[model samples]
Target: MINLGEKKLILASQSPRRKELLKGLGFDFEVRSKDTSEDFPINLDPSEVAGFLSAKKAAAFAHEIVPNEIVLTSDTVVILEGKILGKPANEEEAFEMLFALSGKTHLVTTGITFLTLEKELTLSDTAKVFFKELSGQEIEYYISNFKPFDKAGGYGIQEWIGFVGVEKIEGSYFTVMGLPIHLVYDVLKNL
Candidate 1:
């Protein structure tokens, strides 16, 4: 168990996966989604891009933070071949990303920002996921059934495709899911 010193928790995201992950840690929090453009310069690395976006989202609420409220924001991205693959625009793009990731290892990065009236902390977690070779049919089937337009990398590690395709993972599974619960717990404990 941990104690947060009178800080009201606020999660600034609309992702159900992130909400669910945070709930699993047994913290009481409120959800407040913000509208922020997620654009970044093309030259930023994958992890840096995620961190920047996460902080950007937090900064969007800088003037709204109450004295006793802490806001949390996060961004996750998929990186392959040194290129960042954000959420797919359509099924065709989803298929392309999944196909490109088939039988390969890729990095999943989740950047988290904790903001309060007097302090801010931004951290990122990276996971290496290895997938077995996926057939074209399997890729199409997964996309058709899962419709992962909101998920980075066009797949969910907690879903059917992960059960069938993911061969190994080298870091926090929850990071691939969108939030790093362990890191969040630790950070909150110290906040």
Candidate 2:
């Protein structure tokens, strides 16, 4: 467990995966996020999307932050062939994303930001996830059951597809899941 002396932690995100990952760190925290647009500038490099969004999310708390409280915000994306793949809008889009990812390696990038009344820090982590060739039936089953419309890459790394199709991962698994827990721990420990 990591300790933050007299500091209260606030998570400014709605992602269940992020909440769960943060809980694994054994710290008490409160969730507080405002509705914010996820859109980004057209010129941002694919690699910078996550970090840019994360920091943008953190800005929502700019006026309300109090001393002794830290706000955490994060964003994640799936990049293949230099294109960013965000949450799919529907089953058809999800199927298309999954099919494109089939038998290929993609980068999963997550950006995390820590904001306090006095200071702020933002960082990004990337993981290479390689998938096995996914059959149409398998893709349909996973999408129909999981309905990953809210997940970047239209799939969850902890779900059924990952169980069978994820052949290799090159970085922190937690990053692919949405929050890089190790980095979070390290940041909080030193803060």
Candidate 3:
């Protein structure tokens, strides 16, 4: 367990998984998310996409942060063959994304940014997720039932697809889900 003394932690995200992960850490915090553009420079490297968006999200709160409050923002990206795979737009896109991910390994990167009135810290972690060869039926069933439009790579590792399709993960499980709890805990505990 960790204590923040007089400081209040604010999560600037709407992700249920992120909210749940932070709450599971036993920290009392408030969720205040404002919609921000996800677009970034097309020239940025795939690996830097999350970090850039995370920092952009944090900067969205620059005018609202108080001295005793810490705002945490995070973004996760799925990269395959050097291309970034974002959340799907619809069932067709979801199916396509999942189909493309089948029988391949992809990198899941989550970038976290902690902002206070005085200082800021931005960091990212990468996890390798190997998916077992998937069938069309598997892809259709998962997409139709789970409707993973909110998750990167059109999948959630904590969901049914993860149990049936994911072969193995090389990094923190929490990272693939959304936030890297270990890194988040370490940073928050030290703060």
Tell me the tens digit of each residue's lDDT in model 3 across 87-168: 9999999989999999999999999999999899999999999999999999999988988998988999999999999999
lDDT of 3 at 94: 93
RMSD of each: 0.8, 0.7, 0.7
Candidate 2 local lDDT, 1-191, one digit each (tens): 67787999999988989999999899999998899899999899999999999999999999999989999999999999999999999999999999999999999999999999898899999999999999999999999999999999999999999999999999999999999999999999998
* lDDT at position 189, candidate 2: 94
Q: What ranking of all candidate models by lDDT puts the best one first? A: 2, 3, 1
- lDDT preference between candidates 1 and 3, better one: 3
Candidate 2 pairs with clashing backbones: none
Model 2 scores a TM of: 0.98
- Per-model clash counts, in order, read 0, 0, 0
Local error of candidate 1 at 4, Å? Answer: 1.9
For each candidate, give its TM-score against the true structure: 0.98, 0.98, 0.98
Residues 81-112 of candidate 1: C-alpha lDDT, one tens digit per residue:
88998889999999999999999999999999
lDDT, each prediction: 0.92, 0.95, 0.94
C-alpha lDDT (0 to 100) for residue 134 of candidate 2: 99
Model 3 pairs in collision: none
